[model samples]
Target: MKAEGGTTCGNSTKNDSTEEVKNQYHYPLTLPNYTKAEGGTTWKDKEQVFDKAPKRIMANTRPAAELLLHLGLGDKIVGVGADFGAPDKTVEKEYSKLNILSDKYVGKEVVLGTNPDLVFGRGGLFDNSDGRVGTVDTLNEMGINTYVLESSVTGGTYTSIYKDIKNLGKIFNVQDKAENFIKELKGRQEFISTKLSSIKEEKTFAYLHITDPKELNVEPAHDETFFNDVFKMVKLDNVFKNETGEVSVETLINANPDVLIIPDWNTYDGSSANKMKEALYANPKLSSMKAIKNKQIYAVDFNYMFGYSYNAIDGMDILAKEMYPDLFK
Candidate 1:
């Protein structure tokens, strides 16, 4: 399938923090206050130094859950959660595809129901205001290990994916697993690089983060960011380089990106992509844009594109394949 664009929602703010839905739970708990770190706030690991792999694990996103499965720890995941926007079926299907037997527990109440020992999630997972899962520190205080994905909290490049795996390996007492996983991941990158090297005539693209039909945000192109770095590797010029937030239709029409990237988040309704495409098609200002003109609009999953994980390599691969079909064949 043709994939389009990159993503950069920018540094998250306290006001925009995710709100955890409170569900009924029967678990012992102690919550903690939020503390600010250097660049962002962090939950200090109250129960550091895990002697072995956590038998009961909880990961809140598809990519995180997939990463654990990649490390051959699917059995360790006792509970999983899907994005709030995901359907009930997708929640099960995503995990079952990984051969993991876990339930979708989105809010804190559902999470506590599973009684996980270690939780793997982005900072967004802990909506302290709702006091559902409480804060990350709260879980830690309760003797539950919490490791938030750095990419979500602190931003990172492609290399950070390896670090995530390596860190998990260290915590799980499976350094060898981490190393082997990285080796395979390196092989994936090498293969893509081989494909990328043979390519010429790379096209410029724009990833659109559209929260509403009328408003849009283009991923930061040519910035010192993971999204920029990946596009650089694939040799795609970003039409909206260094741009962010509320890209006007006139500006988007003027920039004229070769391709348009749409995410699963905004398109969660299943019909959203089509609605967006139709809207763009009907707009006199956007109809003539190169992306729309050439049918270069592509829909993609959020985790593989915006997320910082080994899974992101798939995003890179998808971009490369679309840019140079001959390289893939």
Candidate 2:
């Protein structure tokens, strides 16, 4: 498990946005060409409406900040919190300039301190059970709007990401920027589609995470997440797509996937990928697996695989090249 170079692909797109996918609305939505408002409901099934674009916003996660910055709404973001992963290099400089409200999750008091009109982030940020950054309803009651990423609410898919981009564009009145970004993503997808079209067989891969170099967790394919959709885009099959929650090592070895897809948590803990891979390699039970024997394991950026952001396209591109390097070259 050696560190690999990052992709040279600049903001290319993924699988087509033709599918009819509904976006998760943490913020209010206005129907097109309607002068009067009829109000709207959120993914949480709560009522919310917006009369104008949010000013003095707060990005609650790294991907949220990156999306806002890419939309040219960086100035609108008053502060950021809960940034657990590294920001992509494209937005790294601008992201570094923003006021960090907190390194981990922000408390409700800290959120109110920013005096933001809206708090934008994935769905996880709204959990108020622990009372850190109150629930979406409480935030709305406090006169602040909230937006959850659609992908977070309704499984991770390219169509969902596209819908989110379009929705965010309309919400922030940055339709042009959002449309351009979507188009770029589509272009990249088309490039991948063309390059890999010659291949007829789909390779099987397992998206996994390892903590303590012993316990391995597999992401289910049928789950509402990005792995399955991205795997399909690259013409790969998920071995654990049918199973749910913590499949045993024996189950993984029994399934015997063609490739092992691990999230590179190196940023959080140095040499984590190497440690995990080393343990897997040293294990006697896993040696018979094709991925282990052929050394077909890939450690990808955690943000690219886990979050419901536009950056998933980068993750898709990385997978495409990794499995089919000859075609890419």
Candidate 3:
């Protein structure tokens, strides 16, 4: 027998006479690929286990939307939750073509209207909200299958991304596409790693969120967050390594790292990058820090640094090159 793609299976290839060809040809035919393997089995029957790609998929968060686009499944997406940012001009154009609106769904009516076969989301997007849009129970009650990407779970690393991609591929019946995407992503990560590995001097950095003049939050580098991974790759010491979750402004002032990294600062809001720096300078306690005194503060794209998508690698590259220009050069 042969699979639909014209690959031989079962008893092997046969000539026009329907006789087994044997190993007579210069190139022997390899056994058909099977999903499962057993011990001491000469050959197993090949089966196309899954079919019928998901017709309508609702992405509950920005990272999921980005991942789907990276996986070449953006066209399959029927709906996307709000908060997906299209910063790059090319990506913005593509997003416009897809008609992905960054609007929140207050009820299931819009999602149900799409008639989605599957719903994809990170746990927080559903959990942190009022449980109205993409909750598992709600979707299941509507006869829609829901899949949590799992990478949204805290402590997710590169390995988690690979596993999530594979799982998604299996669900969507696009394993080959998923494998190819993983290969490309992994290759890029490896290249970044190789570029950073030779650095002789590493900088000590701190990630600070300037909520206001009186309030600030600090994320430690060893907290298993995406930012943590990026800092680790560039061999920077995160001053907040001892703490998990957020920290007070006093803690940041005390740590006073070599490089101060801020996110979400360059917006229309009052906390623009320049304003944050000004605030830092005005604060006598923080102004004494080496980083502040030397003007070593840097701002990153808030969405990219906070998000765990292909862009996280981009963020890593930017941080690595910025922190150690000589090595990257």
Candidate 4:
């Protein structure tokens, strides 16, 4: 079995995470309390499960679209959601690196215009309130199969990506592809763990989600299912380990973390991470923090880390290299 799509390599490692992955592979989805997103549904247990391959599918995010191609289900995909086939990018320019999907079909529209029988969202919350593709439940009720990537469930882990691929494979009747995909991902994780296993030092780290001039929504340790495994895998301390609840600028400054893992998403100055780095350096109050002073603040890619897709292996590798440059080199 061979994996279709994986990490966008940038001089990374190759190693065996098989044993470690087997030991810590399964991460349970206990569900989280959401303020804005959908709530009160037993998704892990009661959600709709697909029995056969869906035709005329809508891949809502780039990662979702990528997963379709990886599964060799590109032909089944009627609409490529999340701006992949937008007017600006031609099919050639959009998927130049993905040889498998080079000649496959792609849609320029985001929603209903394609009239899809199924919709795949990277996250759990997608209500009709947004007025784009309609809610998952609505689609499901209308006889259209819908699935929320397990990773998008708040409190999901790296295992969520594997679980999603596996579940999707079962749904699409392609179990072989899912198993191979997980194998490849574990290999990538092993690559990072083997290279940086010698380190015992634990640096206090925080994942700043939104970095506006006034405030930032930081993922505290209590609610960080994703980053906890990531930081632990690389042997780094999470700053918010002892605390929970919403994070503010004052809280971050007071904690004075050893490293700042800013997952930048906004599209400003090429990428928001660079923009965030600039903002932190210029801010008089934040400039004095330990992470800022030592220049240990790293602006990481959003989808690679927070995207909660198969790209998580790439996220893990990025963190390891950033945390231990000497070891990787």
Candidate 5:
């Protein structure tokens, strides 16, 4: 059968026999003389592959940190977002010396001063409505090519993150590094998938984002949230499957997941983790949930969950091991 772009990988309509057409003059072939060509002053000889590298790059999100690290071009960074949490100790120390965090979002003037060749970040960061620091149009007008990694628009996953890295590598002409990075991440994912597949009983889970003092937003596992992807990868059923987009406390109480994954507790103080547990346990309506009763509630770093990168792999491993020790062990 013909593929989406009218390209066939296997037997074509013209070549009905199972015999493979190894010539450049085949019916489906668009480019002629591609196979018969020899080393000469041809199109391939004159084709100019760009060796020019981007002098400076500005990252406006946390995921960019991983991509930049993988590229091993951290020195090219003229400015980084306040939220770019580098896990590498060497990079972190170098970044601290740069003292770029004090200004939060690097001003357009500061970025311009650095003369960045490219600006990479999530598209949402450019929104002026929610106090966005920069704009793609503004950067474009100033002759700076800006790439808003589209992986963040959908659910973040290891596949998506790898795609992002590959895309960046293509743009930066670092395809070799990108391929190696993807291979490593895929190996890790396969290892985790194999381990979890052995488990007979998969635990039900609910992930919540506590945005306010009294409000708990239940994140559905099958929706746009990346955490859902993590849970599904480990064969865990999301209790709030029916719910969509920031579920209410009533929904949380109704579904009552076997385990609740609390993301981002840095905003609270005074034994906030304990208090969150206590509050859930003390609540007459929610106290009966199996998760609360068994004290299975867990908190993870906000950066690990929210940021779209290999960090999610870390979060997945942590969650999987916590929820099912028998499988992960």
Candidate 6:
């Protein structure tokens, strides 16, 4: 699925000098005594059992494709479509090697041409009425299994993401890899939780979307459910939790969250997260806000804030480290 709203493109970039420096600090250390493990929920109720592993798979998004690669299923992917945003640092090499079905969303005919036994992506890729990749039922009738990330269906949360990962593991018969990966992610989550356990108060944060560089008008991202869950993990609260429609600058100034989470929309020309930061700095009305005064603003890649994928855990890690550097150290 595309980044929420037609005007913006969500992804991360390495070329930005500011982004470069922020990537330097890794999560300090996982606590040795944090004993909680991820729940043992299976995907039986959410998905069907595959007769055999799908050999020729067509991944409908960059996140879906990269997750497959991480699962050691790279050879099984016949083609990738709708790879939005900057590539993740961990999977860039493997992602570069995949066949590109389309730079944007692939059409139904193109998906059919690929002759994939399985097509996996977010729910947006299989919209029947919109005519993008058609419905899951249509694909199923054509003898192709369609798997939509459960996170997408359930309004996006880490729990739903885990389910999707577990389901994919069962589909490909790679339960060991899936379990191992989930364990690592859960460890990261526990690390963040353990670090923040000492905090007495929570900081307020807003995830902003800047569509026009010159105008500098910001809107709340559409995927608040996932980001909200991530924020809760890091001890940051969403100021716009009850908000609806376009959030005016006046409202933003009045709310004045402790931190501002902005997206790095790398897909557009002459538009970047740095520009949004600059725009925020230039605005006189926004100067009085605590996020500006304390310099707690962050510009993250689209995937970290909005994309439906397990790498969102990595994004959560980034935010946690940024907000509480001492905890990680």
Say which candidate scores most in lDDT.
Answer: 2
Give the clashing residue pairs of candidate 6, or none. none
- Our tally of clashes for model 4 stands at 1
Estimate the lDDT of model 3: 0.61
Per-model C-alpha lDDT, please? 0.62, 0.72, 0.61, 0.62, 0.60, 0.71
Ranking by TM-score: 2, 6, 4, 3, 5, 1
Clashing pairs in 5: none
- Give the runs in model 6 whose Cα sits over 4 Å from its true position: 1-49, 129-131, 221-223, 266-272
RMSD of 5: 14.4
Top TM-score: which candidate number? 2
Model 6: per-residue lDDT, tens digit, 109-220?
Answer: 8888889988887665565543367666677778877787766543567787778777777677667789988898889888878987888788988866666645545556
**TM-score for each prediction?**
0.70, 0.82, 0.72, 0.73, 0.71, 0.78
Compose the digit string of candidate 2's lDDT tens values, residues 168-195: 7888766878999889888988988899
Better of 4 and 5 by lDDT: 4
**Candidate 1: residue 129 lDDT (0-100):** 46
Candidate 3 displacement at residue 276 in angstroms: 3.0
* Each prediction's RMSD to truth: 13.3, 10.7, 10.6, 10.5, 14.4, 14.4
What would the C-alpha RMSD of candidate 2 be, to one decimal place?
Answer: 10.7
Q: Once model 3 is optimally superposed onto the true structure by TM-score, how far is the C-alpha of residue 227 displaced, in angstroms?
A: 3.6
Model 2: residue 123 alpha-carbon error in angstroms: 1.2
What is candidate 3's lDDT per residue for 1-329, written digit by digit as tens?
A: 33333445443444322422322231222212221122221222332222345667887756667777766677788877655432544355445556454454333565666678777765444431443354555565567666654454456554667887887666555677799989987897888788877766667888776566456567665544545656666677677766856677777777768898877544324346667767876777687788889888777766566555556666677766776688767
- Residues 1-329, candidate 5, lDDT per residue (tens digit)? 32323446554655534223322222231111111012221111111122244658877754565467667656677766645332544346554544253224555565566667777765445543333435655565566666655444444454667777776666565577788988977887888888877676767888777644256667674544555565666777777766646677777777777788776455323236666766766767677788878988877666566565566776677767876788755
Summed backbone clashes in each candidate are: 1, 2, 0, 1, 0, 0
